[model samples]
Target: MSTANRSVILAETPTAGAAVWTALAGLAVAMGIGRFAFTPLLPLMQHDAGLSLVQGGWLATANYLGYLAGAVICIAWPPAPARAIRWGLVSIALFTIGMGLTQQLWPWLALRFVAGAASAFVLIGVSAWVMPVLARLHQSARSGEVFAGVGVGICLAGLTALVAGMTAAGSQATWLGLGVIAASFALALWRPFSSDGVQATSMAGGARAPLTGQAWIAALCYGAFGYGYIIPATFLPALAHEAIRSPAVFGWVWPVFGAAAALSTVLAMRVLPALSSRRLWAYAQLVLGLGVVAPVFAINLTVLLFAALCVGGTFMVITMAGIQEAQRLGGAQPARAMALNTTAFALGQIAGPLTVSLFNGGLKLPSVLAALVLAASSLTLGLTARASARSAESRQQTEIHVIRDAGDARTNPRFEMS
Candidate 1:
């Protein structure tokens, strides 16, 4: 069917409004499995596949590279963004299946790249679809209960993988489980994704273009956090068991991280309108730094759990806000700013583990993470302050417009008298 027919059908449906939120939630779920859960499972994947650390690193890098490629592809190809997202989810599912069936380094690497690319499409496309509708549907209570799908999926996926790996069922079982989950979501989205996401597409189109200088600073700050946050996310469990000597305790940490993320996203949305994004970013960064690096010194269960909750809860939201702000700054050219931010973040993801690994060559992973967190905290503060200042100016201008409109109304004596 054509776009007009699609729109008309949606307009006629009693459930149209509700369906939009469901589509949004679906996208969030797909993204969580496709993008966020892999890091926690890497150790198992490496052990089962008999892959060396370097090869595992390469596979992770391939995913980031593929994400970068996918972001560009979505802009260049302009496949129905919703459809692209669904297709990407399917690709992730299939590649994950391939991971289960094949163990040779090159094929796994290629599959991971495909998975990464698919993950990008799922995340960007889905967010683009839902963000604008969320913007209009509710101004004060910024809930994306849909986004919670990500947290839930991540929590479940990591919990499953950690348990499977620990049970000595081997890494393949974890991979198989992930494949089943991903494939199921993929097929669900593929069959009727377009009809489900009508409003999401229209909303996505409102994103702005090339970012302001201030926005770039914000992006850089976010990218820096990406560098720091991902190290623990990708390798915390492995570090917990192998480096810190507590596989059992850290196994539980992954789910805690996911649960915290779900809680944080919901709470953050509720609190979004009350404070400026800058304030939130600053506080969130502080929490994240303290959380991720705390494990460096206190290699205990309590500290590990605390760190997982802090970082997992805040990092993704901060990145999401950064992209949204960039779009606000550069109307119609959001793709460039967002791409720049994502690419920088991906580069950081690529760098974080490799850098930590070098230090972990019989040294300390947590120490490296601590140092990076300190740096991230400092940078985030600076950028948050800058963005805050700019926002104040923008709000001031809006206030001026309101005042001028009021003055014009006052001066019109006829209307005033009336």
Candidate 2:
């Protein structure tokens, strides 16, 4: 290659790699520590702080409510993606640290709520900011790497919890450790998420049209996904603890869950490149539904671990595909579309914990209901994809017919317009 060509390659390669890693880090902090660090830490809190399962459900609901609020705000008045991400990360670090500092239930609820909202902002911000850069660089395939950050973060948090559990450290200490980790990640990411040349244009635009039927269905299915995975996502470690009665044994569940989550995205991209986003989401949802119901059928260590793998493996895949579908359906207003879908998802998440709490910490009935919802939504998504395909095909045929008629009119001069 010429010198100029070599220079172009070098510049593009670094930018693409940097964007992917940065987005991945942002998501890891926002999602793993900010949103879900609570999962692995829940058993510790119950052990050390006398926290009840019902209260835990309430705490989880608080966070999900905050996430819903945050997503709604983004839809109403979207902020600059970089600014949102920076502030959200800072807020998550602070809130996570606050969880370690306080003992009161109310304060914990409040801290978790704020942290949840912050996670949403970061999630949307990362999606909006990084996807455009990847698309521009023709590195769209690397989008999976960005989402895998969630799993990586989760794995690290789970490991931290595992170590804390083995050492007999208090929940407060674990929370503080996670906070410090979140802070370090935020510091590393602060400068990178600052305003850059690759402007996140989606943040500035508003939806021109109301959501279509397909968009609504996508949102509904995404909501089902949120509900389907969250029960296991939130309570897997606790369930494992109940069965195994050993922190060393139970701690491995969350880490395994995170590892499966992180690995599944890369594998899916490579193995199922031909599948449409909606179809992939449908399949993943079906698997997640199975995962959700697995432990209910057999509450053993093996079943719990299998449940983790199933739930963890597919949630991010569904998230990635669901968001990509939103972007596709959003037309010029992808951010708004994402916010809407996220709002639906947050609602589903809120319901999950509340369902557990309402049932007095019961899992069987709730798991069965969630599985049914996932199954129905999966079928709907698959059918929706087929309908969309047929619609697009019909439009193409109609356009082709119009072109042919126009050509005939021009050539024969018999059907010509005035």
Candidate 3:
């Protein structure tokens, strides 16, 4: 290739990669730090911040409540995706740092609520904005690459806590440190999320489509995945702490969970390129169901780790597939559809801690709920398949009828006589 050709090729190479990475960074701050920094740090809060288990549960609920509210607002009154992304990232950084500035319970609750809302806005906004660009670039498969940020963020949060633990930084210092990190990432990603850079695509028919039955099924399954995963995710360290009573060992559970999650999404795309998003989603749901029940059968550290691997590995991949399916079903208005799924997911997260609290045990009621929802999700897939088949059959019959009518008209005796 000539020098100019080489320069053009080199420039094109970075465009897709840069877009993907920018998205990755955006999600890391919005999701990894804003939404989930609390999970790994929950144990830390108990030790240093005088946070009770009940209070921690309430805080988790508060965050999800904020997330739910955010999703609702996004759907009811859709905003420009680019603007939402920029403002959401800034809000995430501010609220995350705010968590460290105040140790008061009410203030912490308020900050967490805002952070949760910020995270949801970023998630929905980024998905709305980025997926289309990738599709236009014929990089639809790379959407998984974008969604991998959630796991990356989760892993980074865990690692940060691990480092904090090593330095004896306590919860307050850890919060401050993560907040600064989130702020830096937000500042870096601000450029990519600009209004001029990420133009909103027009939906087909110049309007958003109504949610279909299949879309609702996908949303429900997504919600189930959220509830099922949050239990092990939110409380794994605490569970490990109960068994080992050492931060050294228990601290590793979250990192392991996050590492598996981060890797799973990337691997899933390569492993299942031919797989339909719905099928991938269904299989992931099954795996998550199995993971949820692992601790119920055995309380060993090994079993918990296995459970973490299962839940972490599949949740994000399922999320990616679910969102893609929503877009496929809803068409043109994927953001609206995605917002609904996010709302359902937030509801599931809100319910998870409360369910676990009610049971006061590991992996009993939550496992059952996860399994039941997974089963229902699978059933919905079957129904959709059957419905599709029947529609195909009806189309074939109509075609046959049209052919017969045409033949009869051509063979009419009056026309032959004329």
Candidate 4:
């Protein structure tokens, strides 16, 4: 209402606590509008652009390869947060726009690879760069919503592509135009991105405590999560259409999945109160696995929607919570802990598509078998959760002993006489 209040609201709303989500939304648009949008528009593009299915798929793979590379860079460089963020933005813009700038398969493959690399950086950098500031800025519960921005962006891009299709044109060139728009999306993020009013320091002081034994378990669990949810996140809508043969109804599902994730995060805040990130993450993974498994048996579009509502919705919560849990177990070197988790997640993601490809588009018994493997790995969460609890208990005991020893010396008669 008042001037100061207005300024405070602006400072805190999109720009505070979970501002990285806002930044992520922009990156998501840059990353998703072209990458995910391509899947929906692939048939049209293949026909109009004179592209083959194999080549088009390769383009997608190239982007993913680049994304993996970006993740590697993120894990390797902990001291360069701002630099990473800036480079990520630049790479996103370049690769996103590059999608529209060229049409040939060779050139497109190069750009898609670039885009994938940029997207990976953005995802990894958020954990490496923006998360610490967010944790200190807002309640742990609120950070859950930040990861949902990917869904929001994905949904938005999907909706954008949908609308662009509904237009009389519905041409593949429209995809290029969407790519053009994506190129500028990240530019809006050029301003200083602060989380909960904390300017991100390129490097924070005070070394993080070394990760506990449990930390590796959490990393492995997070990695498993990467494999479990990505298939649904990336392919659910396509599956919806293929299974039900209704792109219109099915196409809208991914956004709902994104919205589901966004709302679930806000909901989890009301339910889970502590910084027990490992438990929250494991819980999310458990939900995610069910979400993934449910639709596999879905007889209709409604089944897919239910799966989206469950697993698709909780993806961000698991990711944010995993990062937090690792931070909790990690004593002085959170950067290193984060790096470990980053590496594991990257490995899982790289494995996701390859594993799915082996399924041959879920044709035979192999697809169902692979899905079962993912469902089983979801239990990795429970293992990590137990590890986190043990680590927390150990930390509490250490602190209690420190306090007790300090108190005993203070109370000793000799010290008092002196």
- Per TM-score, the best of the predicted structures is 2
Task: After the best TM-score superposition of candidate 3, give how far the Cα of residue 224 lies from its true spot, in angstroms.
Answer: 2.1
394 Cα displacement, candidate 2 (Å): 10
Model 2 Cα lDDT, one tens digit per residue, 167-232:
998899999989999999899998888763354468667455565567778898889888888899
lDDT by residue for model 1 (87-195), tens: 7777877877777786677887788787777877776666555555455454324433555667777788778876776686667667777888878877766654564
Candidate 1, overall lDDT? 0.64
Candidate number with the higher TM-score (1 or 3): 3
- Could you estimate the TM-score for every candidate? 0.80, 0.90, 0.86, 0.78
Looking at model 4, report the run of 10 residues with the lowest lDDT sum.
194-203
Instruction: Point out where model 2 deviates above 4 Å.
Output: 1-14, 389-418
TM accuracy, model 4: 0.78
Residue pairs with clashing backbones, model 3: none
Residue 308, candidate 3: alpha-carbon lDDT:
85
Once superposed on the true structure, which residue ranges of model 1 sit more than 4 Å away at CA?
A: 1-29, 52-54, 75-79, 139-144, 195-209, 243-248, 360-418
Cα lDDT listed for each candidate: 0.64, 0.89, 0.78, 0.61
**How many collisions per candidate?**
10, 0, 0, 12
- Alpha carbon deviation, residue 393, candidate 1 (Å): 7.4
Best by lDDT: 2
Better TM-score candidate (3, 4): 3
Task: Estimate the overall C-alpha local distance difference test score of candidate 4.
Answer: 0.61
Q: State in Å the error of residue 26, model 4.
A: 4.3
Q: Candidate 4: lDDT of 23?
A: 57
Model 3: per-residue Cα lDDT at residue 310: 90
Q: Give stretches of model 3 more than 4 Å off.
A: 1-14, 196-198, 202-209, 360-363, 385-418
**Residue 95's lDDT in candidate 3:** 87
